[model samples]
Target chain A: MEFDLEFALETVGPLLMAFLQVTLVVTVAGSVVAALLGLIWAVCQRELPTPVRLPLSWVLDVIRMTPLPLQLLFAVAIFISFDGYRKFPDTDVETIGMILGVAVFAIHYSTYMAESYRAGIDSIRQGQWEAATALSLPRSRVWRAVIIPQALRATLPSLGNWAIAMFKDTPFLLVILVPEMVAKAKQLGGASYQYTEVFTVAGLIFLAASYPTAVLMRKLEKKLVY
Target chain B: MSDFFQAISDYSPYLWEGARVTLALSGGGAVVALVVAVVLGLCAISPVAVLRVGSRVIVEFFRGTSLVVQLFFLFYVFPLFGIDLPGMWCGIVGLGLNYGAYGSEVVRGSLNAVAKVQWESTTALSMSWPLAVRRVIWPQAWGLMLPGLNNLMVMLVKGTAVALLIGLHDLTYWVEVMRKDPEVGLWIAYGAGFLFYYLIALACSSGLRLLERRAQRRLGLAPSKTRTTRATAEAVA
Candidate 1:
């Protein structure tokens, strides 16, 4: 367990490649999924009738309440089981299964994202809605032109916060064998028995990436405040 | 459905053991987190620059890194330095430190939210800083911080699933094991886990909500029945 500087330096290249290729890609894609799906959930919650909205809300609550690793495991298990039933090649199954796992990640986080969007929408003044109504604007136009823009602006910082949260959570993708940064670090550590050096570097990389993003988000949050 | 029930019955003892571990980790971590939150939070707002900066750095570093890495570091690396912790202890410490960093923000925010007038009043009364904080500031700030802390607590419970990675036989670990058994099957294994976790989460949130309600009531933010009745009578009069 001596911290080998050389090994740590060597470890960084592969870890960063895994990070940029798998970890960063999953995060960016997951964030996009969260944003779009979360917005849709928010809008649906607001506009749908009680019968539909209540059940939908409950479902989202279950998603939000559960630990993400469980969701990923569950989704992967299902996909893997489905792969068993299908007449598919073995190699392609893992890649597709991991994609589905990332989708599950997006869906899980989207519940949280939906709450932020809901808060943004709730913060909109009644006057804006009334103004749209007084103008006799169509429902879709009012949503498109008036409501969504304001809510999106208000929610940008919180959305960014969720994205950071999602970024941190990308490590859990290792549960489903996604070969993300932490998984790469673990593999390197296992190979070299330099868990200290490798994991410390991995932790440092996480800190380096997330800390600045967090600071930037705080600044953006402050700037966005009227 | 019967097959699912059969799976649950077969695995109940094992699952229960895992649930106990999960609960233990969560409860222990929460205690650790509370202590860390208060200490770091106070230091963050302390008059001494070194204390403030030191605590801020610790908070940011813990908050920045992924908890899994931290857990792995503790479990795998710390032993190298002759600082061996049990697997469960590693999980608890990891959960505690990570969540504690987040909880410190809630603590700092709620403590800062206490009115400046209250601070000045303590000075007016010639109260010592600790006495003022213990008797005056904390009572008010406690109520405000509970809601945020409750949210974190629920999160901490969910986070205990990470304990499985550290070789702790937590609930998630049991479910994962069960999933590999064809008798239990994937659906039953995960379905049962989902229910168990959801129930635990629901219980934690509702229990915390009750505490929050009582705290709010003590602060007079929640309208007590007597107070509401009295106010209605006065309005009628």
Candidate 2:
């Protein structure tokens, strides 16, 4: 059969969109988890006792150094055997896969987020800490009031950029059979030898999504410069 | 643990062979990436309007898309157009283009970060444009570019894992092969895989650190007293 662009688009487009919803959900959920966990790690590493800090930092380094796909595979091997991995007997396996996929992505990205947060924290004026101390703010109060707010503000662009990265990386979940967009495209390709058309459409979908988000991120970065 | 040792002893030869491919792919891809980075990076900063716009478009297109798709395209689609490449070449070219896009930015940023006075003084000395870039600008920029390039080299090592997805018998592929053996437990197999990758990354990082120090010294950005530093110091004046 000829390479029918119309047939490929008509047949594969909606399937890919359905998968895009899964991708978006994972990206949002994973970004939130990563941002929170990374911030916590950054703060803990700096302030916690040496007994807790050193090993935590070493683990973060390992996480940062490893390729993400291997970590996803490792997560699957580890989590699939758990009794509670499915969460509910009635839950679909794909849903469980999505949850595990998000967990792995969050864990992997949290290390990078920690580095970004650490940089933002380090960039804060030393006098800000001294002034907070002079004002008799407790350590927790100092972090909540003076530190995290500024750090998060400084790091918003990076967080947004990482969210976009998470968006691209959702395809990795396909390795565990999570049926993200690329997986759907592959399924579509198998039905007809139009892998080219299907993957092109899939790539365009990613570009269409990523480019606008990147532009918006650039705008946010400019606006947030204070 | 007993099984782990048995599998390692049995598969050590295969794993070493795989490790060799992994290093070769990363090393070869890094060379291609560095060439692409410097060329496109220079084009990006060139005075010609078309060159800048053309390089920017090329870089953005590569950077914007997922590398997996790029590899897939190179693997699957190229044969359709009658330009068939070997499996490993697909991985190398895909990585070269993707990370080259990234490295170009590092090159451009560092080149731009060189002190503006350096450029102006070089121009005032009646050096030609290319001469100014080579003699005055690049020496300083090279030092700044080293750390970013070093980071990219480590990233390249990790990225070599994707070659396995495209059916290249790289380290990750061998790891999967060994891991799939019912005799070898998953934990041990994955642990060994992680060890191999981590060690490669660690070596790449330290090697690049030595190169960075040399670059810094040549640019006199380091504190070490040396003849090169003295010459660079005089040249800076």
Candidate 3:
């Protein structure tokens, strides 16, 4: 029951490292989905004439309005059900479920990011859009040439904050047995009956992973006028 | 079909019991977090270099980490250090600390949203720092932080979903338990849980907003930052 710092670190450190890799994998995959679907959602919001916008909006709403655990559970159940019926059976179902969960995570978050983009886009001053229209610059060209980069740069600090959040949030995957940091912490804790050093080290690793970027963000925010 | 309604008809009491526990956990955790967030939020904006840096470090450290890990750390990990907390209290403290970091930022931002001129006026009035803060600054910050504080409470409710992981029988955990009953079906269980959560969240948010507006009426203040953060993060985002 006593805290043994050295022995605990020796035991749980490597395991936490492995789980941190799982966290990294989930973060990357989820970031990709967020970026891709984020852009799609952005485009849909801009080009509202498309018939698909309503359903897409509803899907995003469902994704956003629900909690991540419910989403994760739903994702796991759906993947299990769907995989049970079709696709190669028992072939990396956890991996599939994790990806789906991450995608759900991405979509859930990207709605927030989409608002950031919308804010950044709004910051362009309506005159710029008017000028683009006046110059006969196609709407697509205007967004590509004049908007996206600036919107992205303006959105970087906020987006980085969310990236760190998504990393922190990877722990919820333990419910599905994805073996991320918290999951690994629990495994190591139970295996050794020493949860103290294991989860403390895990928390420190999470802090290490995220704090520098936040410091850098504050610095970046000060550098930018807007 | 009949069994589904009967199960809910009978099991409604257990579900309500669980929801009450969830409410107590969320409600108590929120009060502790509110005081902590305000103090830390002010410390975050402290003129003293040491205070500001220390506060920032603690804030980022908590916010950057996972809530469930923090909860597990308290429950399972603390006992390894010879400190035992009951499961529900452990859950509450973990959630309070984690969401308190988020709340601190909200509080800090809303406080700063007050004008530099207001500070100048307090200085012009030749008031002591505490006097200035209590009389002039805090009222303005209250209007600003109210909506944000409400939203943070809602986010805390959402974050409480993680308690399901550590096997604390919150609303989500109970719904998860209900999912075991084949009579009601899994999706129905989950759907009912979602509906329960959405109703609670919607009511909490709308109630907070109503209170916020009432407070605004009493204070005669309207600030942009508080309104936007409340609208975006708490209710919608």
The number of the candidate with the highest lDDT is: 1
Clashing pairs in 3: none
DockQ-based ranking: 3, 1, 2
TM-score quality measure for candidate 3: 0.88
Give the per-residue lDDT of model 3 (tens digit) for A89-176.
5667566656776777787778766655665665667787788789999878988987787677766665656666677788888777
DockQ value of candidate 3: 0.41
Displacement of the residue A47 alpha carbon in candidate 3, Å: 3.7
User: What lDDT does each candidate get?
Assistant: 0.82, 0.78, 0.72
- Candidate 2: clashing pairs of residues: none
In the range A68-136, model 2's lDDT, one tens digit per residue, is 777777777766535555567798878888888889889887877787788778769999999999999
The DockQ scores of all candidates, in the order shown, are: 0.39, 0.32, 0.41
lDDT of 2 by residue, B1-237 (tens): 787788889999999889988988898889889999999989988889999999988877776777777887888767777788998899889888878887887788778889999888987899987999898888888877777777677777878878766777777777767767877867888889888888888888788778778888787666332212111111111
Most DockQ-accurate candidate: 3
Comparing 1 and 2 on DockQ, the stronger one = 1
Top-down lDDT ranking:
1, 2, 3
**Could you give candidate 1's per-residue lDDT for residues B57-160 as a string of tens digits?**
99988988988888998998998889999998998899999888888887887788899999999999999888898899988988777767776787788889
